[model samples]
Target chain A: MAYNDKVLEHYEKPRNVGSMDKNDLHVGTGMVGAPACGDVMKLQIRVNDAGVIDDAKFKTFGCGSAIASSSLVTEWIKGKTIDQALSIKNKDIAEELALPPVKIHCSVLAEDAIRSAVDDYRKKQKGGVNASGS
Target chain B: MNRVDVCWSCRGGVVAGEGFCPTCRVIQPPDPRRDHFHYFGLNPGFDLDLGVLDTVYRQRQQQFHPDLFVSRGATERRYSMEHVTRLNEGYRTLKDPLTRGEYLLKVTGFREQTPENATPSDPAFLLEIMEWRETLEEVDLKGKNAAMQLQQLRDRMMETCDAEVVTLGKGFHDWFVGGKREGLAVAAQHTDRLRYFTRFLDELDRKSELFF
Candidate 1:
C-alpha cells in the first residue's frame, strides 16, 4: 500500500529510535506486541522529578505503518506530562497520518504503547524502584 | 461450475465439487463458492489426512490443468483454468498447518483482525517472547558454527510452533464438539501466536541460508 506523505516522512526519519535504561526509576518502559501481525513495539519514557516527560524513545519491529505510529508518538509525548500524554488517542494519530482503515490498528497500537508506558511509570512511582507489579 | 445444465456423467443437476459427483463417475471440478474443506470434500476441522489431500490435489490438477485443456474450446479452457487455480489454492491452504488453522478461524465466524484483538496479557507469555527474541538475536550475531546454531534455532522455533498448532487443534476440536464461542476465540488467539512464531522461524530460515 502506498503510504501518505506524512507516514513516509516519519518512516524515513523516525525520531528517537533507540532504548533507555528500563531499570531507571524515572524511566517507564512499555513493551507490546501485536500477535496478529507479529509486530513488537517498545516505547520508553523518562519522567522528570517535576512530573513532566523529559524524554521519550522507542524501538519497533514491524511494518512501515507501525514504525511510523511509534515514531509519531515519541514526538507527541516528549514535552507532555503523563496526564497530557494519556490524551493522545489512536484516532488522532490515524487522522494525522491519514492511515487507511486497514492500518488503523497501527495507530491503535501506538496508543496502547503510550498508555502502557504511562501505566508502567505510574506503577514504578507508586511501588518504588524496579517494580514489576501487575 | 454451477450451471443449470446437467452433469456430463450422471445427468445430475449442478452439484458442488467434492471428491467427485456422488452418483456419477466424474471427478467434479472445484467450486469457487465452497470453502476450502468443501472444495476438497474434507470435514471442516484441523485434523486432516495429507495423503488424501495430496491425491485429491493431484487428481484435480490432472483433470483441470490448463495444459490438458489446450485442445478444448475457449469456454471449457477458461473453466479449466479457474478450477485448476482454485484447486491449487485449496491444496496449499489445507496443506499448511498455520494457514489451515487460520482458515478454520475465519470459517468459524471470528474474522476480525483488529490490533486490539488478543494482545496476550499473560505476563509469562510476554516474558517468554522476550527471551526467545534475546536468544535469536544472540544466535544471529554469532559467527562460529552459524549454520548449526541457526539450525538449532529453527528447530526450537518449529517445536514451539508445533506445540501451538496442537493447542489450536484442541481449540478447534472443543468448538466443533461442544459448540462454544469462547473455544473459537481461544483457537483464533492460538493462530495469532502461531503466525508470530512463524515469522521468527522464517527469519531463521533466511539466516541459515545466508550462513551457509
Candidate 2:
C-alpha cells in the first residue's frame, strides 16, 4: 500500500473540499457511493452560463484512493469547458494517480461523479429553471 | 534456566520425572487445550444471528486487535497477532452457511466430496432455478422487459434467501444443542442449495447491468 508521494500528499491535505450554494442555478452537485466498499463521494461544479466550469469542490469519505481520485478530478474539471470536462475518463485519472488495480474503482467513482454533476447542470439549462437544491 | 512442570488440577509445581502432581493428581502438559466454540463463548450450532455475531466479533476484535499491542513485547505482540488472525478466520467461516456446513463436515471427519448427496430433495426447487436461468437467458437475448423482471426476481430471491438463512440458523441450534447430529447433514444439504442460489442471484445482477 505504498502510494505515490503526490497522491498521499493530496489525500492528506485535499484541496477544494467543500460545498457550493445549492441555490445557484449554475451549480451542479453529485453524490455517489460504491456498495462494495461502502464509500461515499460528493462532487460539485459551478458552471457559467457559457457552459464553462468556473469552480469545483468535493467531499469524499473512503480510503486514500477515493480521496486522491476525487481531489484529482476537482483539479481537472475547473476552468474547462463542459465538453472538455466530460472527456476526463476514469482510465486517465487512474493512470495519472498510478492507482492500484483494486483501487481503480475509486477512479471510476470519480468519473461517474463528474458525469452526474455535468448532467444535472445540463438538465437545469434544458428546463430553463433554477437548481432544485437536490 | 530451570524448568518447572505445573499440575493442571492443583496448579502445583511438579518434578520433571513425576507423571502427576501429588496434591491435585493432575498431569503436567506443555499446552492447554481449547475448543473453537468455547474460545468464542458460543455453543456450537448451525444457526447463528449474524447481527449478534457481528457485535461479538467487533468486541472481540477490540480486545485482541494488533493495534492495541503496538507497544507490547515481541512475544506478546506475536501471540496477539496469531490469536486475532485465527479469530478472524473462525468468525468468517462460521458466519456463512456454506462455509459453516463445510467446516462442520470437516470437524466430523467427512472429507469425501459426495455428488450423490449434493442435489436437493425438492424437485420444484430445481425447476425454479431452471426457470430463473431461462428467464435470464431470454432477457439477455431479447433485451426487453429485463429491468422489471430482474427487479421482481431480485426482490423475491432476496426474501427467499433471508428465510432460508433463518432456517439454517434454527438447524444449527437443533444439531449442536439438541444432540441431533443427523440434523447437521440436513443443514449441510440446505447450505449447498443456498450457495447455488446465491451464485444465480449474482449472475442475474451482473446481467441486469447489460440492459442499463
Leading candidate by TM-score: 1
Per-residue alpha-carbon lDDT of model 1 for B34-78, expressed as tens digits?
Answer: 888877778899889999999988887887778876886675577
Give one digit per residue, the lDDT tens place, for model 1 in A1-134. Answer: 79999999999999998888888889998878887777778889999988899899988767799999999999999989999999999999999999999888889889988888888888888888444544
Docking class of 2: incorrect
RMSD of each: 4.0, 18.3
Model 2 Cα shift for residue B38 (angstroms): 2.7
Q: What ranges in model 2 sit over 4 Å off?
A: A1-134, B1-36, B108-125, B140-145, B209-212
Clashes of each: 0, 3
lDDT (0-100) at residue B144 of candidate 1?
Answer: 68
- RMSD versus native structure for model 2: 18.3
lDDT of 2 by residue, B75-144 (tens): 5476566667766877888787767766665565544442321212443554455455556655643656
* lDDT for position B116 in model 2: 20
- Which candidate number maximizes DockQ? 1
Poorest stretch of ten by lDDT in candidate 1 chain B = B112-121
Q: iRMSD per model?
A: 2.6, 16.3
Off by over 4 Å in 1: A1-14, A21-25, A91-101, A127-134, B1-14, B18-29, B112-120, B138-142, B178-181
Question: Per-residue lDDT of A86-112 in model 2, one digit per residue for the tens?
Answer: 999989999999988888888888998
